[model samples]
Target: MTAGPRRRGPARTVLVALPLAVFATVGVLAPILAPADPTANDLAASLLPPSAEHLLGTDQLGRDQLSRIIHGARISLAVTAAVLAISVTVGVVAGTTAGYAGGFVDRIVSRVIDMAVSLPGMLVALAVIGVRGPGVENLVIAMSLWAWAPYARIARARVTGLRASPHLDALRLLGAGPVRIICRHLLPPALAPCLVYASTDVGAIVLGVATLSFLGLGIPPPQAEWGQMLVEGRPHLASAWWLAYPPGLAITAVVFASNLLGERLAVGDERPSILRWVLPGRLRVRGGRALAARVTGVPATIATTSAGDGTLLRVRNLSVAYPRGSEHRRVVADVSYDVPRGKILAIVGESGSGKTTSALASFGLLDPSAVVTGSAMWEAGAAARQLVGLTPRERRQINGRRVGVVFQDSLAALNPLRSVGAHVDEAVRNAGNPGQRTAIRRVSEDLLHLAGLPDPATVTRQFPHQLSGGMRQRVQIAIAIAGEPELLVADEPTSALDVTVQARLLDLLARLRDELGMAMIIVSHDLAVVTRLADNVAVMYAGRIVESGPLDAVIGNPDHPYTRGLLDAVPRPGTVPGTRFRTMPGRTGAGPDDTTGCAFAPRCPDVVPECAHQQPRLLALTSLPAHRSACPRQQSDGPALAAETARDPDGV
Candidate 1:
């Protein structure tokens, strides 16, 4: 399951991290470590320059330069720490809130951040410091006040991007609240960059503080600070070179240390692989373990499970719409469905039929601009639950364990840079299982086999870009089924494959259902494909289910005219030459001002005057139980009149 080159503890990391850690620790103990009192004056040593008694000679005030520089370490570290703490805290909170709260809130927050950024930070800090006198607390406050706005802006931008990210959206649909979604899924990824920014800022901030103090507007006199010493020694540069050089060198060293540490930490984390041994054994082993966990199970969603129900997943009256210049255009309307433990209920539809939107809304996948006013329920297997109104963490509990998805596009789904095995392993850990190297590889191989891929070992080692389209789809299937999920929602899994490959994939799906008893929901425009695979069928048009029922009954005796038209349009081979095929009249389009009776009325062949005056309700026709049609004239039209109904297109 290992991917590419493994991450190792670089020589540079140790070189930087160790020294900075040592420096910071020593700075904390500076008051005790200095040989002479940092503030005490000696008249004899004053203006005497460097000597055995005074390693760095004395300042104009007769203070030992060496002692003062050592003591100054305490102030520098404190200011750096204070600025980091204040700015990071303020930035993370404000950025995430504004990012998640899109539209007017986002606009307003972004504008304020922009305004702050446009102003010169040093100038602002100077103004604030001018009002407040020179002191440790005042210096820290001044730097932080100017520094925090940038952090906030960065955090907000990340949150804005992550709020719409697939992972966060998945958590949201699982009933996660805004706070949990931001904190768990959104925050961790954002923190890596934030940390790097904070580290780099420390050097600039320390310099700023020093610059202020040197100007006599920083720490007060007699404080034994480096900046104050620099100011006092300026007049004696020709007579005494030792006093100024020592403190300047110390400042330069600390700044360099800060830069080095920040760069090492910036590397953050990388996926584990066989090559990771290039790193120290401990990190390599840990990474291997983590990769193993990912391949074996579902990735843990940042959702909670305390709100009980084995409800697993649910959606009720979920409607979504896009805003035009002045009006809202509906995309998903009054859609609802639920999946219990170990069952798959397919939502079938064509492009723009709202199949994807319905799926997304079930897990909160829409943009924040889209208005959502429905409850999605979630119940872990054998656990009672409410999917809607539950926090994002709660919903996350079911994402990998109970619900997994396989999209139509496989290549776009998996990461291009990662190997198939490592990709699978990532999911295993995300599900919170034990991550061991051997275990992950074994699980990854098993998943490949389960997906009906040949030569599991060879395939697992290959990157996504190296695989064929069908093979990529198999990998996607492996990922979706990695957690041994209770429900698998496959959106046109075989659509992209040729007929031969499609048949094989369908067989694999059927086997999974028979062997695992996992529930399935497959959306497709191919009725013949659905007829063979699905136990029940749903026909969707214009963002609504026009008809739905058991597969046989729906195909044999479709109650909806739309379904009949679709069946008439299916290509049948071996027909005579020059024969014209049946085609559904009118193109699919949604006008902003459209307020017609039925959405499909413009396209329906059996459109009557009444059909254009009122919307149809889903009602039972004189058909088998569980079969329903959303049409005004169903049972009223007898079977003898079926031939005249909609003219059956042109020819069979």
Candidate 2:
């Protein structure tokens, strides 16, 4: 179940802020509040307990207990702050570099981090201070040396995970520099938990300084510190317990507050799922109709699937082949399609149908081992260009700006560390927008709202992990559509959603297409989904399209046997619940070379002698000039035609 909205009120904020404020102030103002000189020699007034004049009573130093406690504050606060700073900075940098660079650098860094962690913090600090001679600087050096290793190790682990995240991949595809991507995407999440650690560590580091000082190995006593005071008060502990107790309590208070605040802050902000916020807002309604209009400029023919006719994107004879183990085979073969301005075209196929591969081919984002050959041309307004044969820089200039994609998995698509608003801002920035930071953030909030997220301002402040699956998907849509590109490629955009959520997402996409006038390519395994949003549908089987035409004509009377089989697969409620489902016979085989005959023949019940021996070209199936099919016997054989003509008699 989705989490309910977080209550926002002064009580919660105060509960979080009060302790932190108190601790911070005490730590920072310690030096000014000592009732007596912490370092003043008081050999005469030594060993006195609670008294009216002495208040908490005099210590072994004849000095006021309160004064000594206050003085100790300065030393502890400095040590803690210094250690935290050194550790966080060193850890984030080292880990980020190691994670992002990977390979040899990562191995070497990991080894170094492991080696460092083998030593305990106290031991390391003691060794460093022992050699350096105990002083403020030496003590700081000791604690920092001990502190940074753990931070580095954890940060390294987090970075390693982030390096492989899809958001990073998406950023790379958009031409983000290594530093920009790492700092923007990788570091934020890595550092948030670290922030909590760092906050808590301050108190511990301060205590370490006090410990060394107490042991005569920390800050030499001309400078008043809690440990020094404790050491000085040791001789009179029985009588002057006030001296030691006050300072001890002060340290406890600061540490406790910091710890509590750290834990609370660590919970982070709440972020709802983007799919909820974005998809429904953009597409859905109570009436279950696509009330939104198609995008301007797209041809009406394609708009029926989503609207506009500007030839926003075109792909010609695209092919992509991935290696099996070490052997080579083409996974996607000779695919072609066009995305008109402000229109929706759905690519329908089962798993391994090459729908995704085909999309990947258009952008030259195939795996290194997968050889890709294709020319994709795209135009928006006056911006006409060819995607194939373009250099990295050239592709960078166009990808996020001219073409945007909503991946199947929104969580995979978004950076877990970043807030929804930031991701949207990134898309806008990548598109070459000149807005200021404030404007960018505002636009992000607005986009989140448009995507259907509530409490836009608060939601904008949340990281991806805070959101639900649906909300995350909505944010992904927001980011993808943020740039307002001419072409939007949705690869199984709603595949992971439940029926209601899926319907809502479909409605949102249809609305956005009409409102923004953007052309869309919806890739899915379900033809029903295509029928909902596609003006034109292309049925793919074994990496090739077997049929193509208007959605209504194609669904009403599928010419290809494979296409008919797909339509029959959509489940219908209230049907005989336990009835066995009809399924296509054989799995999609390997590529063109894997089989000499039609790839579907093994599964095609009407397979003939000629089907196994000859390859068939996509041919016009009827007088409907736009309708086409790849089956060789489309013009002949009543048996196969009868099966193709058959519908779900049960209305399922």
Candidate 3:
């Protein structure tokens, strides 16, 4: 179920670059394109206006203005190219090294760049020309001397900001050398902003060259430069306007085009709606109501049935698609599962398997770009609420109050600036807890204590950064449970943590579940982690629930090949040292909409010819009524998934 056509780059970018491209082309082909020799003098043909032979007319020196302007473009392009080449290379290399090295090197480079930027660039060029004597080489060198500073500044800032990122640490752990890390990872990203800046610098460099030539400090006389032509035609403005205007207009077009191209590149996808006129529907969000109306593609009259007896949250035929260009691409499809009361249901899968996506979609936690469809029945007494299409106000009533979510990255999840107490206090207040400031703080500490944090009173006062990764995660859990939520949804809660921390967190979750009787949906990639707490396990592959049943039953005897592969990948208690982990044999990035048939067919060990041609249906096994497998070959006497859809006539 894909939507509109694939999107392309911004239309305004093309419009902006058109003039620049034309100028570049003229510069490159000036010799062939010019009608006559620009420097060849003929006083008889001089002062000629628009005519059959001379399109842009001639100068006072009898030089063809068109040819002169074209040749002038060649000169301007040369200067710009030289300056950018030298400036970008020098600036980026120096700045990247300084930022990566940091300390004294960073301070020295930063101070030097500041000094260069502070000086007037035009004045620096003029001074250089005065000292070194004027020429094309001198002009490029002068401009580049001052021009390199801004790029250095941009690159330095970009690289400095990335120094503390976790990915760099990951690279170090992977044994990547400094040279490999900097060249392969750091330089590319640092260069992007520098290049964008250079797009803008094109105009300045071209203008500077013309300015110098105008003052007789640029290209020598008789070189047919735009500024030289303008100065020569100054006395003949009323008589031969063609001489000045042609070059003047060319310079204006180049400057305008370069500046515009730079802005568009910097803005990227956030550019204004210039293309909406050309391509109707804009294909973005047509309207909030319009997009919302089409979200589920189901009639509003069709309501969800009550959840099963012991089910806290029952999701059926859940699907989520994100907007790809104008079209929608489905990630999760027909994912069905249940979270029984007071029990942990772990959704297990490799990366991109849509395990987290399906869980997030069930609670309306997916971003606005997501188009979700399905029936997620959240049981409340005798009645049930459909979580799929709930309005913001309605979802808010349930999500933060009834369901608490803990994301994997605690640093990202918690505001670094705020104290842990502030975070939990806000959550308590948001959950409609009415209390004085003191009472709120006390309750916040109590929530932290309940989450198993040590010395909640002291922990509450510390910021997220001051705490350990495990502590920060517990803080998130504290905030989540501050609302006294019935269902806790944790996405990769123990990922990237030490074994001790992971086990402790898992134990805490299990304790909370057993003591408080909390129904939980835990999303994890490791089946070993799931084994610790999960009563039921749903194995996802390519956005579909390939197999799901009681954790013991499914883990002991996996019905689907994908499920078997996942279980096999789990680290066993006693394996030979240095033995490679047994992993599934195919790429895992395909979505449900990528193919018509089973997405895992290329990787499936028991793949039959039919697996490539037909969409497999999830069927129950004759051995277990509660269990189901998407693979049709599995021994089972069960009804078709179509039957389940048929039962819910107008459902997901």
Candidate 4:
């Protein structure tokens, strides 16, 4: 899937990483690499400048500056290694544990991490050294104490963000325990950022140790150190320049290497020079990323236009594909549905079924690699817009401003740095409100309250992390409705919340529809999750809608095997005790066009021989004009399908 790349990753590994490697190697073999004893003093050669014997000249006491610098590399690198090891280990463990075990423990640990970060790191090291006295052990401990907080903070943020992810949800569904989920799944991604941060941290530790040694608290005298050499060379800075320059250059080289290497690794690209990449923003990057984009500006009036017909959004044969190798692979194929005014349409499917892709692709919200096609006539109004081919500029006028979205992951959607008020206020401004500061703040609080947050004033001041899952989702709703959008698209908004919270959010959505007369398209993996929120439901399988109709019609008389399986999986009110959830017996990761015949034929219990040979088109059922099913076995009254079925019986 990642075959097409415009640029190769940063080649700075040659420039920076190799130098850092050489630094480590020199540190490891300092004794062998150094020509003379760094500590051996020669009165006869004292104060001699650079020559054949002493390459970097001699310090005031005639200690070979090159040897001292080489040995000093050993001390600095060792201290950095020790401190990094200790800090990374403690930080990752503490942060992972706290992030994994949330609520009070997470709050407590987060506060502790914050305090640790707030402390003067150098001062903390100094205090630790003051108590324990100067030595390698004390220096390592002091530096480690100073260093651990940043790693902890990084890990905690990473883990916290991932805690409610679908991957983790899937793990839990598979009966994986907490330890397995955290260690096997969570640790790898969390560690990537920490390791990258550690690359930059190498410089900080080396500099810290050098600073302490320069102040006489680190590596205590006679043993040659870079900082000690600098101190000795201080008086002769003007007369003999070689004394300070070599060690100074050595320190600069190590620091520069670490910083550049970290920058290269973190960005995951070769050109950290001019290009910037982020997951979602003004400029977004994803798999086989499109580096930048140009304007496809929307006509000004389309943002305020309304559909006169009952349908708010009428999508026909909508297809979305991403480049896979040389060809485009369809993730969503010929998918069609509608969101009627003041009604909720639910798109339900298993993970990778492309429910989210179909909804997001309609709005230009998918990764830039996605190539979308077909007509999405975004309103039945006279001034209707075709959303499929719209530029980002045009999509923006409709999406965030006219049609709001509440993402499945509210934590990911909301900025961790920005408070609730800031997010809402920004949305309000972006929605074209452009109100005064006090007026905007007031509107933001009102919107938060409208989204079902009781204490809007208190909630406004809190960050995304400070709020619970339900609160965060509510905040997302507030931000979404800042534009008073006619349409709302919520992608599994309540999936991460508890039953009570989920119920409350659903109620809020229903209430919003009744009050604002807004249409909504809600996407979900579990059919049961959105049953309460949706008026009409479309059950998607392998990127195709298997069945779609009114909530009761599809739920009660599910014609497609996949739809039946989804209905079976939902726990019933009068179910027998200890009954296991009935899951379909196949993976849900195939494309609609991957199989020539029925995509679900292999997994379908009712699969006939003909089902393996031909794909079935979604046709109107004999029972109802609005209801439709893709399974040929589900009798349809459509003339073309009926005649084809009667003539061939197998659609061969």
Candidate 5:
């Protein structure tokens, strides 16, 4: 179910392509390759066995069996290809249109597809073929009528799911039309599964055509069709086995090959070659180790640092960068924060603000392509461990067991194929508790209940897709808490839900935090959510923290201009109907290649000339202890920073 690219090896390629190549060659060259006229009769050579002169011998009336089989491939392949083209084309177009343009059109199309699929496909094909008498053209038309129903169903389902995808919304915002969105975004990924289905359908279609011909309702006698040939050789089964065997073997081989090819292509098993088994386990391990090291680098081990008082997790001088040609592009720069035990620290920022990057780096979750330089020290009892320097194996020991993460989209984070119980069970196993396997169900139910799921039993049995957005999120929380983690990271957990659901989920998280007494970090762009949940808040711009303090100190009296602009931008109930919403003057200054100056200088409303020359260090405020802002012009407070009482002063 992952959308990641599949790797195909040479063995798999050969497995899929070689059979197809043989069939295609035979079909294309039937006329040129036949040795003798398939319809030519010779009473003397009738019922002959396979011989060098006639090769697969002669059928009744002296027709060359080899010639007939070769020509038969042409008939079967051509008809099947035509039927598939028509069916797939009609299905894809109808399904895509209906799915993209929902409501009336979708309902109408869904009903029609349901009706068509409900009626037996073979029965419908038989009825049509019976009404239109034998002939290859009529036969193809009969099969295509129901063939399209399956394709339409598949296409509709795929498109319906993709319509809700965040990527499609991004495309719409970029001004892409419906046609472009369908072709560029929807069709490409959907086509893969459809292609797999179509491949498997080939063998079935071939068999159906052959069955019709054998019944004397398809390609007539002397035409040299495989099914007709089978009928002719039936009476001479004992005396002349060659007449039936050749065509039967031909049909069997082609169908078998088609099915095998489809299976290999669908699964994308890269190590299909037997040579893999021949290699020694030690050599294979060495090779894999070398490859992993080359790609991801060996995990560095940093010595433990002294822990600060009451700080459960402390991050210092954190910077994350990715390789760009010979140099590196920093995404997060010199970020620092500390999470006190049993408290919430919210990192609030705009989209490109590097809040999420810094959080991910603290947990060692970022990819190896990113070079993270920092000291993320976590206090465990009397000892402290440097998370940034731990090996992947070492990190795994604490990740699910001591630290848990809830991602933005619950649907994307949870496996669609797995039941909620299975997800929780895996988490329990990972925790490595004694007798966990035996008590998995009980433990999972308890976790679900703790996460506030109404019917734990029902939810445990249901898959992620079956649940609503809020329910899926609750299930995700259950999974995260199954390990009884000490530190929980909720990364925009309620962003996708409606206001009512968001509030409920936030309340649930707050309750969990208080009950478990776990240290938590909330990464978000929504200031309302942050103020409601976080005790301390850090405002990030570009890749660095511009302000940090208690939520009340920061929101009640914002020091940085960027933070003030953000507060003003929030829509309030008292704003005049015709007035425009307040917005920052310019966009974020973060980019792959940027100048060495204050990142918010380009957008700052009261930008001083000195702002563009150098970046300011985070300095403490005289008014509030532990309150800091990265601004040189602290004496000049803009009008926008003035308190507005009419706004929803109660935090979101």
Candidate 6:
């Protein structure tokens, strides 16, 4: 059954690809294929008419028209190939250099291209030929000089547009040099259009060479070139018309065929002929069917292997790093945690502290540039799966079905074009419950109602813009729970909402957690929100979890100086009017070149000399074994640490 499409692919490719192959072969083997010497002339047979003895008859010089036409293919094709090579090479290098370098270099190159493009191609060719004198070599050189400008403009525009791609920025963050980035990332996408342009240019180049030859400037006379043949036949046109028509017709056919092939390449129709069928994997039609079958089939069930003590997900020694010159900067360093079923574990940190990075790593959603080292064991229903090294396809099978995520911005997460119901319907389909149309609709409404929307039916019919901020967030939660995933990772779910809305949304999440019995990972910088929702809290600083324990213990009895600072910075209700709000003493940022010692040492209020010299390891408190702090001076009493506050030098 699959062989039908596979068989047809080669036939379509051959139909489009055959003419170019035949033309190139005949041109390359002109000497062997020609019936007679193309340059030889016999006065006795001058202008002989078409007959069985001499096909295409004789030119004005009595040379065989068929042989001259065949040999002309060699010259035209050779010059066209040379022009393509020289023009494309020079244009690509100059254009990519200018676009990637930008600023001064871009301005200079753009002006040069403008000036070059302003000059007429024919006039520039004429001036070059005038200086160097006319010949096949000079003609090629002159054509290349003008031909490269167009390709340069095309390549420059393409590179300029792609300079800001996120993939390229990620490469830069990974320590890739400018040369490597331009060559590997910028050049490939720019090459497609340049190649298409080169294809179409072949016909123009052939026409130029012939025009020069007809004007008595190219290939001299007895070469039996098509253009020279045309010139020779013009004077004898009144008496013998066959002499002019054959060469003209041959030139027309070759140019038209080249153009036809160029158009096919531009439109992406020239597929790999026999290779399409021989290599079954490359066939899209076959691959699509196979993918559809796999998606629809019963999902592979996993055996639930406990990480220990009923933990739903266990992450051990999780670290994420990006390259910096010769070394790597760890963003999340040796972080470990566990979330039991129906429990909320909040990862709290300021921006760039690696809270989100660590959360994403557990789900195998980190970028390719990040080097993640650790194990994220997810216990799903009856089976346990390791998420760190799963292939993308394998990860896809579990992501929406076993683990769902509600991103920070509801507006960005919900497609503006799609209705609220459409988003939920997609999640329902992804959960492998793609039932009949009516059933899918009912399931979508049920999921929305479960997410706490008052009118699930009305909300389902509205677009993302038609809903309020809280409603959009509710829709997002509805989509997240549509799959009934065992674990839900909410990254700053209520950060964008007003205080009233934020409180309502938090309550909705708590209700959902209880009703669904799903493990939840709440990622937030807001400690108040974390206090209200999280059963356990992990405080992060400079990519490492500086302190972690039960919520009341970590917040009421803070241990690490950084954690203490964060708690002090939060605003409380009893503060007098006109008083300045507390702020952390130092700014926050992280990079691969972090010092060997503690990352938060510079910002620590009670920093000691040893804090800058030795990196602290997260160790369990002797008093509370489950509670851990990375500080060497681990105070036994949380109330004592919380009582002490450092006075800021710059008071507002």
- Top TM-score prediction, candidate number: 2
Model 4, 241-281: lDDT tens digits are 99889888888888889998888778764322322232112
Whole-model Cα lDDT per candidate?
0.69, 0.71, 0.79, 0.78, 0.76, 0.75
TM-score of each: 0.63, 0.74, 0.53, 0.54, 0.53, 0.53
Off by more than 4 A, model 3: 1-309, 635-652
- Number of clashing pairs per prediction, in order: 49, 34, 2, 2, 0, 7
Pairs in clash, predicted candidate 5:
none
Better by lDDT, candidate 6 or 3: 3
Per-residue lDDT of candidate 5, residues 1-652 (tens digit): 3433343354556766566567678879988999988788999998888889988888779888899888898888888898888888788777877788789999999999999889987788889988998788898899899888888888888889877775455345324568877775565445556666787788888888888889888787778888888999999999999988888887787788779767765676532232233321121111111100122121111002122339888888888999989989998887888898778999998998998887878777666677889788897668988988677678777788788888777777765544688778667666664343335566677677777787888898788889999888888787777666777898888887999999999998897676667778999998889878998999998888899999999999998998998888777778888898778977886552354667788888878876776666666666764777888576344322223212312111
What's the lDDT for residue 185 in model 6? Answer: 56
Off by over 4 Å in 4: 1-309, 635-652
Candidate 1, which segments miss by more than 4 Å at Cα? Answer: 1-68, 95-130, 153-199, 221-223, 254-347, 352-485, 493-508, 540-581, 587-652
Span of 10 residues, lowest total lDDT, candidate 6? 286-295
Candidate 3, residue 318: lDDT:
91
User: What lDDT is reached at residue 497 by model 5?
Assistant: 90
Compared to the true structure, candidate 3 yields what TM-score?
Answer: 0.53
lDDT per residue as tens, model 2, 30-68: 766556666677788776677876777776657776665
By the TM-score metric, which is better: model 5 or model 6?
Answer: 5
The model with the greater TM-score, 2 or 4, is 2
